[model samples]
Target: MTIERFILFSITAISLASLFYIPKEKYRQALVSFLIFQAFTWPGTILLVQFGKIEFPVREFTQATQVGFTTNYLFYPMIFVWFVIMYPSKACLTKRFLHYFIFVSFSVWFINFTTIYTALENPLAGTLFSQTTRSYITFFAYYYISHGFIVWFSKKSNLSIGG
Candidate 1:
């Protein structure tokens, strides 16, 4: 298969495999985080594609949707699940901020690198800031907003966050 297809398939396999790593006691937390994060990613991805900010040229469900189904609906949410479950809850404000920075930074870097190497156009390239800058902003926004929602949900449900 082509490298792009191979990369996508590998990502899918890894994401699926990550699910088994979640502890049994945290299964409920994992499910809640996954579903809630998807609530943000799905529409956020669609809007990004719709407005020409991004495109997944090699993606599943192309005929049904322009969004990258595997990345938006599955991979990203799974990442968020781990993020919430492993959060450094007792960390000071600076460390907490660093956590956000680290996650967003790595995600954006990996995404930009992979998409470019895989022959997909970089999202929001040259919109205003450089492509990497714009991607950082976009990813940080998604993570921040979804994290807030997850925290709120956990509070309302009386569920504890962090391992």
Candidate 2:
């Protein structure tokens, strides 16, 4: 298989396996995260592609679009659940800030790197800066929104993050 296919399939498998570990109560947050992630990523990617911000080599009737959507199906829920579960509630501000910084920084870089290596040859038409900016924005938005929803839902439902 091509590296693209391998990466996608590996993420798919790992994602499926990860689901088994999620507490039943937390499924709601995962679902919400997945939906919101799609809400952002699907259209955002299409606009980027159409506007020449990015390109996918695949050209079979929106298969390229499917790449964006499907890969997200794997990653977003896992990330949402993980962040909620690992939230350091009692940590000092410095530690919490470092956690957010590390995850966001790494996530942005890995996500952009993966996009360039697997889905696109490169960001297109002088869109490297724009695409990079958009990526950081989207990912940070995802992180905050995902975490916020989990916190909110947990409060409303009278549940803990893992319970």
Candidate 3:
């Protein structure tokens, strides 16, 4: 297997192990967010290497010294949305998460397209990463929205998998 795949598989295994360490019921509230963080960051990074477009030749830029961002940087924090949705308590955590989600996501997108992530770009993926400080926030918004779905799904499914 490629180095990227090996690294990704390792991360996935570790994340699953984390899940095992926590109690399903208690963790369910924050499960989606945590899982998303793991899923998108490392695994997503691998996928970007595997399937997402890259600018430099794989071998030469092993360090991606010439490139700006690795694939996982932008996708990492999206778990916030999931945090919002899957927040199992009767408390208003979901509402708070939504507010933060909207704020953080917009901020990341605005910053990115505007200039924040300008320096963070990979030479190879000049525009492929499409990340700016603002883009990071947008990704968070995605996480919040996804968490909403996870919450909705778990409830609808009537399964305690997500608590």
Candidate 4:
């Protein structure tokens, strides 16, 4: 298979395997986080694509949607599951900020690398700095919103955050 296809398959496999790492007690949190994150990702991806801010040239569901199904619907939500499950809720503000920064940076880099390998052009910005800046903003927004929702849901459902 081609490298792009191989990379996609590797990501899917890794994400699936990661799900098994979640503790049994946290299964409910994982499920809720995954679904709630998808609620944001689905429309967010569509808008990005629809507005010409991004493109997924090599992706599943090409006939059905412009978004990358694996990334938006599966990979990202899975990552968010871990993000919520492993959040440093009681950590110092600096540590918490670091946690967010680490995840955001990794996410932006992942998308940039994948898009470069799988597409003919950069999807978001012209220069590397500009691309990284835009990606950071986009991903930080998604992370912030989804994290907030997860926190709110946990409280409403009587689930312990980061337990």
Candidate 5:
């Protein structure tokens, strides 16, 4: 198996395993940190290469574009978790689009600019993102599943949203 596939499998396994341990609130914090770590690595790596000219030691082994901290990973899961986590505390405004769209539009626009620049220099290094492929099953798909369980699991325990 390739590195990317291995990472994907490991992410799936660990993410699934996270569900069973949610009764203990402490683990959830660790889980969130771990997920954030997974999200941060690739984009951060590509950014470091583009700006700093750091020659990282690794071969390109995979081309799966549908998942794994590309562009869309952060946004949708934030949306899913936002609703469930905030629930009654953070009031969902009637015009949800008004609040959320600007953030997405700006992020996509800004990131696309960077992507264009980076792709010109090092094409294979960065996450070549598109709209539909953002919703990949391998990565963020678990968030929706875990979001529901997390909401339910956290509700059962004394855990608040952030913790």
Candidate 6:
């Protein structure tokens, strides 16, 4: 496999493996969050790609392939699952704001940088710093809204596995 594919595959593997470590009782909650996040992000991604804002290349910076679909559909959702789980249960407003800022900023930077480093380019590729910064802001908005829903849903119900 090409290096790009290899990297995507490796990440997917690691993400999948990480899922096994979450506590069994918490798995259902995490899974619910994962699915809910995917429900929104998946279609949001499609719209971005369709609008020429985001691009997903295959082995190279040419055609795209669904082979690495798990990178988004699986890997990200899994990561967010853990992110929600790790959130401070009793955090104050400032702490929560700081945590979300740091987490979202780093996450967005990592994703955008990795995409470019891996030869993928988005519509804002010309202004590297600005593009990434804007994307970070935009993604964090989505993250907050979706993650908030997950948190709310989890707390509002006693829904767990087999419930």
Candidate 6: residue 116 lDDT (0-100):
68
48-83: candidate 6 lDDT, tens digit per residue: 677666676653323454223665577667767877
Encode model 3's per-residue lDDT on 122-145: one tens digit a residue: 333445355443346445645656
* Candidate 5 Cα misplacement greater than 4 A, ranges: 1-89, 93-107, 120-150, 157-163
Question: Each candidate: what lDDT?
Answer: 0.78, 0.65, 0.46, 0.81, 0.41, 0.70
The runs of at least 3 residues in candidate 6 whose Cα sits more than 4 Å from the true structure, single-residue gaps closed, are: 59-68, 120-126, 156-163
Q: Which whole-number lDDT from 0 to 100 does residue 11 have in model 4? A: 83
Q: Write the per-residue lDDT of candidate 1 for residues 36-117, one digit (tens) a residue.
A: 8888778877887888877788777778987777777887788888887888879999988898888777767667776668
TM-score between candidate 4 and the true structure: 0.88
Candidate 2 residue lDDT tens string, 48-128: 768776666642246335345445545655655566666796999998767766666665676677756666235666555
Each prediction's number of clashing residue pairs? 0, 0, 22, 0, 0, 0
Model 3 worst lDDT run, 10 consecutive residues: 66-75
- What order do candidates take by lDDT, descending? 4, 1, 6, 2, 3, 5
lDDT of 1 at 75: 78
Q: Cα RMSD (Å) per model?
A: 4.5, 4.9, 9.0, 4.2, 12.8, 4.1
Better-scoring candidate (TM-score), 4 or 6: 4
lDDT of 4 at 103: 84
Instruction: Return whichever of 1 and 3 wins on TM-score.
Output: 1
Q: Which regions in candidate 4 have their CA more than 4 angstroms from the true location?
A: 120-125, 156-163
Q: Using lDDT, give the best candidate's number.
A: 4
Number of the candidate with higher lDDT, 3 or 6 = 6
Q: Report lDDT (Cα) of residue 77, candidate 6.
A: 74
Q: Candidates' TM-scores?
A: 0.85, 0.72, 0.38, 0.88, 0.30, 0.80
Off by over 4 Å in 2: 59-67, 119-121, 127-133, 157-163
The residue-level lDDT of candidate 5 at 57 comes to 29
